[model samples]
Target chain A: MTKLNKKEKELVHLLKENARLSSEDLGQMVGLPSSKVQSLIQSWQKDGIILKHTTLFNEEKLESTHDTIRALIEVSIRPEKKTGFDAIARRICKHPNVIDHYLISGNYDFLIIVEGKSLQEISSFVSNTLASIENVRSTGTHFILKKYKENGIALGTEEMENRILVSA
Target chain B: MSPGFSHLIETIPSSGIRRFFDLVASSKDVISLGVGEPDFPTPWPAREEAISSIEQGLTSYTSNSGLIECRRAIAAYIEERFGATYGPEKEIIITNGVSEGVDITLRTLLNPGDEVIVPEPNYVCYAPLIQLAGGKVVAIDTSQTGFLPNKQAIKSAITAKTKAIILCSPNNPTGQVIPKKILKDIADLAENHDFWVIADEIYAELSYDEPFVSFAALEGTFPRTILMNGFSKAFAMTGWRLGYLCAPQEFIARALKIHQYSALCAPIMAQYAAIQALQGMKVVQDMRRSYEMRRNLFVGRLNEMGLDTAMPKGAFYCFPSIQKTGLSSEEFALKLLEKARVAVVPGSVFGLGGEGYVRCCYATHIDLLKEALTRISNFLKKR
Candidate 1:
């Protein structure tokens, strides 16, 4: 993939800070004219460098994260001869509390993380949902006591860590 | 399966807000500033009405456009609130919340290769839905103008393929309300260019500052505007899955056709309850006042923490710039959650212009907010 050029990179940086930024303010940030900034953004978007604009919510307000417990669930499975694993995965994904789950490699057939109201709820799911599956084996639940970072960014880390860190 | 099922489904990334909450949910003892729903329960009157409807056996489908009473109530409410008028029979169609309203409108309006003008730092749904509809999205970054769209950018982005523009006021992520003058300008452009305006004003009722003006409120502009709103935000009815779309009679007629085949109708019990919600403004007003208090306290603490937070004029979110920390928004969010056990969303999750900022919702309890603030300050100092 082609890296963003100096001006383009600067435009992306400003936009990442506030997607609602005006082209004029964007130009000022990138040292370009408003028209140039607009054109540069248009070009970058056309090339798919800028994927889509969105809103990042304060989920804490939703009380969706109130109990804040992370547990990874592993399910061992043998696919019912007719119905495939994809169908089962989709069924499990439909559960509201299953935030992120993946069909992974190696020993564990599936790696899942869920948010539940309590430890009992998590265990109930493991016992009822996972254990009850026809081709299922026993599962392991790893409760995440801490989350250092995710999506390539570290929270509470110094700003230096966020940079690319080009060596001398 | 649709021909492009994989391609279509893969296009929209999981909401960054949801991702942040995932991290927040991991830490058992964390104080969170990452939620977006109202703190209040669904208004008692509304809940009672829904329960009564169910008790009375009002569970069958009403109509493709939804119950007549609900539509009339919506029309009356909009007229009373913003002087926007619509013929309930022809101009209104209730949907399965604003989420479906947005999804259905984009699906109905855009064609492959069409372009949509979306003001950034707005709602997360607009862009992805536009993409799913096979329309190209042109985002006009609006952070510089106090989170409002620039008229010049709107004009410049217009092309033969421009299908519509989406306006969200008391906007999500950034709580900036669209000024009436600016809205008029946008309406003028839409009129000149012959493109529709899909306005999502779900937070109009919870605005803390000035009164919100509906794009449909402007005379002659109603024909080209589809106003989408819901009871979820204001009434604390997120689980209800009910909303309504008001557009020109012809468009509603068309949208209803698609809606009828798609969702059938908003949940019957929820629709019955929504009717009661509209009839009771006093309850809505009380909730608004409470949100106003939370918004003030949350925004105030963010500013006091030395973060450059924009004082939100409406909604419950405060978009604070964390650039001084020299940390990218994601890094700040992750570290704060892990080290301080306080979770807030990074700005980059919103879009291209969201890098150096983080969004914190004031809808949480005051004690939680204070604790989150303490963790935030400590994290900043250590950095």
Candidate 2:
């Protein structure tokens, strides 16, 4: 694959920052026509260079009363004959409650993020759903205490600033 | 009984800005697009330096010409950025702000009946300042020529009484930067007509389309060009109120006299801050890049909304024609404020050649800009 040009790379970074920017807005920044900008973005999406345009909503902010427990689980698993950790990693990730699952090195073979309604619900998943898997050897789960920062935004501060309204 | 105000003050025409802004100020939840300063806070290094200087008790008033180190730093900055040489000892005077620099330079150069040519739509302060200095203002309307000053119009305006011309590029209200070719023609006119050129380069660092060309740097023009600049826009240090006036020693000598009694030096802290602000151009470059992006986003959206805004080559404003809305500039601004709850300056407030448009400053967050544009689009749709 060919490397993206400087302007294209900058457009990509701008999209990553704010995917909702209109093609007209992107064209203005990248010095291209709206059609050109639209085509560039479309090509990137076709090539799988751009995964998706998504919003990261802080669940805590979205639902103040509703509680959702998020836990990170580290699991040890025996490698299968041919497919290695890929088959078991896929199986662990297929669980409905798993938010994120990654095959990692060091102490654990797989690092997974699980979301559940309660501590008992998460503990049950760790004991039953994860342990029952054929190659699963051992597992450890850690509940998140808080999220100080997420998606590069610091929480608990008003984004809008009060400034002098007008001058000449 | 109260004494009457000075006749000199009466010569300066009334400004509608104060009254108009009062209306905006009285309102709630109005998204203002009328600001003339950068939205960024002062860069950390400059603010840190000022804080340190204050902590060290550097609170005494600087000399009328300001601190020697600060002047030298400014001189170096002008030299590096614009390729203009200036003597730090007598050629530089730090003023309260570029506004003061404008006042002092006008006072130093003008005599009674002297006519100063000002191109419009331009900065809001120049015409009144010229009048207050006992000089007649000859306003040249440049809107017909892509908002760039016309050489023939300027030449015809020149006469025996012509004393100076004030040029601001990238200009306020319009965000139009006079191209190098246009500036050179004006330089030649200044040389031939024997007039001073008061260049308000306060917005010099904000020039986007091309590198900023200092009027003083053109051949043989340094002697005639009184260069004005400051950290207010570039460093995002508007409240610091630090600006520098660079001119010939003779001009500076007289300007120093007026500055000495009228304002003295700029604040000691801001001077110290300026000394650090000039130490690195990284912050300035970063801010300029952001402004460039904002300019694109704002101008692009304005045009898409059918406002017919020309691409601003520099500064942080986008002047869009409101003639299509079947509203005068003032009407558009006032109605937009009332209906859309968006505040902007009417182009007519900028003087002649500005009646059909409105100035929307883009030195704001992109989200706010988008929201303002959306609001304006809706307002246009309604009417």
* iRMS values for every prediction: 17.0, 2.1
**B1-383: candidate 1 lDDT, tens digit per residue:** 65666768787888777766656665778666677677666777888988898889878988999889889999899998989999999999999989889988988898899999988877777888899889999988877777788798789889999999998898878888888899999989998999999999998898777888888898789778999889988877877888889988878877887899989988999988888888778878866765665565566666777998887888778899989988899998888888898777787776657778888777765556667777888888788
CAPRI-style class, candidate 2: acceptable
- When summed lDDT is taken over every stretch of 10 residues in candidate 1 chain B, the lowest stretch is B289-298
Candidate 1, residues A1-168: lDDT per residue as tens digits?
Answer: 877686676567557746876675455434577899889778878998889998755434557566767699887777767776787788788887688979888897888898887898888888887678667766899888766665444444433111111100
Q: Once model 1 is optimally superposed onto the true structure by TM-score, how far is the C-alpha of residue B304 displaced, in angstroms?
A: 1.6
Error of 2 at B319 (Å): 1.6
Residues forming the 10-long window of minimal summed lDDT in candidate 2 chain B: B10-19
Chain B only, TM-score of each candidate: 0.96, 0.98
What TM-score does each of the candidates earn?
A: 0.68, 0.83
User: What residue pairs clash in candidate 2, if any at all?
Assistant: none
